[model samples]
Target: MQIDFTPDPRLYPFQSRWFDGSRGRLHYLDEGDGPPILLCHGNPTWSFLYRDIIVALRDRFRCIAPDYLGFGLSERPAGFGYKIDEHAQVVGEFVDHLGLDGYLTMGQDWGGPISMAVAVERAERVRGVVLGNTWFWPADTFSTKAFSRVMSSPPMQYAVLHRNFFVERLIPAGTRDRPSAAVMEHYRAVQPSAEARKGVAEMPKQILAAHPLLARLAREVPAKLGAKPALFVWGMKDFAFRPGPTLPRMRTAFPDHVVVELPDAKHFIQEDAPDRISAAIIERFG
Candidate 1:
């Protein structure tokens, strides 16, 4: 019920900006000046999810991480559509507004689709991609327990956003290493208000709908991306997108891509193993 607007010290000294005035204010941290790197976070997390990577990569590459509408410090409009296509459009507009060209992209969870959409739609700007614990394929069968709940019972929405139980319980459980009290509190601080929760609450339905856009993206992204230097950093221990299930699909899509499996990591690979993940990105892209 309480929201902490305090900015993280680690995220300080970076310029913040907003775009797509009518849609919602997107709070983004932009730093350094070089080939750009856009970092996108998944559900229940925000730009803070990419904090360590931003710090590690900013010195050599221009790093930009935006809190999606209805998450983090971003404004949550009462009736905004949080569907995949809309999120992808916002990403496209944001990149166009910033005039970013020939940059690398890193994505996780929902970010996986959004970033791929951007690359498929705005190919000229994206040079490479770094994927972590996510999927871009269409699936009729739900994969994870959390996803199965969402698909089976509509009431699960209340448990996730309204009650905050899902965020409180699932996030920490999915991590290989329990996050520090401070980090856990930081994650909770951005909890959406009842009205603002609509965006997140609607995610399950949207995902279930398997909007044609996602299917289109799934088919087109691999072809568009080709062998453009991709890095697949996966968490073998992730309960949601288990590597056994998704890795082969990803490998098929990106045959020439480099793959690294972090056996000790979980869904939040960046949080669970920041140093190793950062080192891998720098080694590949720096």
Candidate 2:
């Protein structure tokens, strides 16, 4: 698939990097030169999601944000499944290829599972973790299941494929503050065609189809990386991944974790509270 989108330099003024992993070529941002912080993104978003955090923290931390294959400026290779497990696999290869001896992991949305999967494998090298509105267990809640089913249904899938529903509708609804027209267009331009939106469309289905992987992470993450310091920057008002249940479940895995509650922010905490989130990261993992 050909993506004709170039990031606005004023908004995303960083050098772009690429990694040719086992899966495909991935576009990433590697800025600053201190302790590395790997930023993993979620559905319908890309490295672009972390632009603010990277700008704020890059002065003191080596901020690395990668666009997973089939998203952002990454290549959408033919025949790729675009499954959660596949994303984890590709990210794992990216980590190994980078030879990162020690780094911090930060993830939100699907990023939580995918980044943690990498951390679990490289537990010795992972010094800490930062998580936001996301999950790594079998998503069996009524709301989760209902959302997955409805979004994966034919009509919703069609809307996502043709109309860019996630970027147009969910991205706005997920954040307390609406994104600017430029920000929305940056997202829309990347996945302008049905072929480019394949990864975005596959994720809703993966919520159910990837349960076994989630189940594995539920066990393995706590067992292996529970000792690592954890920070939960939660968006309390998030429609999905509500703090009431989700935060406690995460605490069960990281009993010694620190929590930074964002009462007004929603699912896309990166968008709504990047400055606060950056401050918390510097305090906890600086």
Candidate 3:
């Protein structure tokens, strides 16, 4: 199935606008005024990843899910740096520009670290956190042979962005059950222009498990989170962060939090088990 690059009117009905003088034109869905529930997505996915969740929760809580600058409807500037710090800064500006204070957050995959950075910097603005198929620590959960091979190969970068090999091969292989054709198509459609693909391509090359920044962030997050109401929803079948390592770390870090593992689901828990996950979020936050 081929992805559609043209914006979907149904998915994005609101008028998209630029924030912080065209750093990017952010795509956001704002509805039913109240304290915001910010939803952050991971790599290769965008605000579209939260469509079902947004539909499920918008009536009860104000939903604010933005496509990170390089991901979805947001502008993907050519030759831009897509480091963790850069992403965190953009998220901070995105939230602050709207004057969102004391809002809850839902994060998955890369969203986990990015949102934590936001919460750490703007603790006063965060009321709660929900983690889905994500991790904070640089544990040995993802040192698979395939992953290691890609990490070691310089050619992997070219395969990922230029050829879409990462999405075409790695992502599907990581899941126990293949994503629906529609969902896969949507994921493929969001890639930015060729010039903008530099950041997208370079992401895998930048991953270094022993990086000091990851360690520092991991150490700081647990202390910062404290006993704030948190929800950990996991997909046991996830290949990247399997139950053995990921769940234990979460349990160790957040002993008091609620943790649910859907044995049949995969890494993209929201896509594979949307109804169940959405219900869990509603029960916890509603």
Candidate 4:
């Protein structure tokens, strides 16, 4: 079944904008007005992940949240590469296409690297960045690496496609907020079929594969971002990212960037701590 890409003002509270650019039809929310704040979400989530933050900040800042090509309301056309590098490239194009200047980027999960990559590629356009529960370097522990391998395997494909394991089970497992049934149902609706769910499996596979370009990106993006205003908000309870390692590495990597740790929050920090996240974005960028 084809997923709905329509932007419902009541459901999303913003006009949906689409641009084919060179890649394809990408869905995004452009709300309010001022310096643009580009919000990028991780795997298995979309622009909807930033719903509350957008609602809070739209009055003061122009919020732009895009569903990556494969996820959310974007067109998941055939023959597209959903690897981390491809994602970052698409974001760069998206920014250029819209002519966003001196904007701020806020990304979570896979968004961390993608947004940072764009900042590195086009430093002139990005003024600052807010990274939440995300990683610029690899954060895999022994167990986590083992888990990623299994989840990216063929067996997990069946789980993601046939059973909704990625959204219904795994995502909530990583969060303390325990998203409501209606919210989860909305997530499940986006990738209602196996074909559309192909990206659900591909992203983890890309992470597990750890493409060489990602290693270069990991090494390079941070250096470029260090010169910009950056804020790090960590959900300390995130076992998937492991507070023990990723958080400290983040602080050490950019010693001067502001950091906020929410002990109660988890991997999906937006669900667990949208208010704090919103406040931090405004504090850092507003």
Rank the candidate models, highest TM-score first: 2, 4, 1, 3
How does model 1 score by TM-score?
0.92
lDDT of 3 at 44: 68
Q: How badly does each model clash, as a count of residue pairs?
A: 0, 0, 1, 0
Give me candidate 3's TM-score against the actual structure. Answer: 0.88
lDDT of 4 by residue, 32-66 (tens): 98888999999799998888889999999999999
- RMSD of each candidate relative to the true structure: 2.4, 0.8, 3.3, 1.8
**What is residue 225's positional error in candidate 2, in angstroms?**
0.7
What candidate 3 gets wrong by more than 4 Å, as runs, is: 1-4, 9-17, 139-152, 174-177
TM-score of each: 0.92, 0.99, 0.88, 0.94
Residue-level lDDT tens digits of model 2 in 160-233: 99999999999999999899999988888899898899999999999998999999999999999898899999
Query: What lDDT score belongs to each candidate, Candidate 1 first?
Result: 0.78, 0.92, 0.71, 0.80
Question: How far is 59's C-alpha from truth in model 4 (Å)?
Answer: 0.9
Clashing pairs in 2: none
Question: For model 3, which pairs clash?
Answer: 102-125
For candidate 4, report its TM-score.
0.94
Kindly report which residue stretches of model 1 are placed more than 4 angstroms away from their true locations once superposed: 1-4, 10-15, 142-154
Off by over 4 Å in 4: 5-11
What is the per-residue lDDT of model 1 for residues 167-282, given as tens digits with 9 covering 90 to 100?
68878888987888788777777774665555566555666554587688778877888667889999989887888878888888876688888889999988888788888888
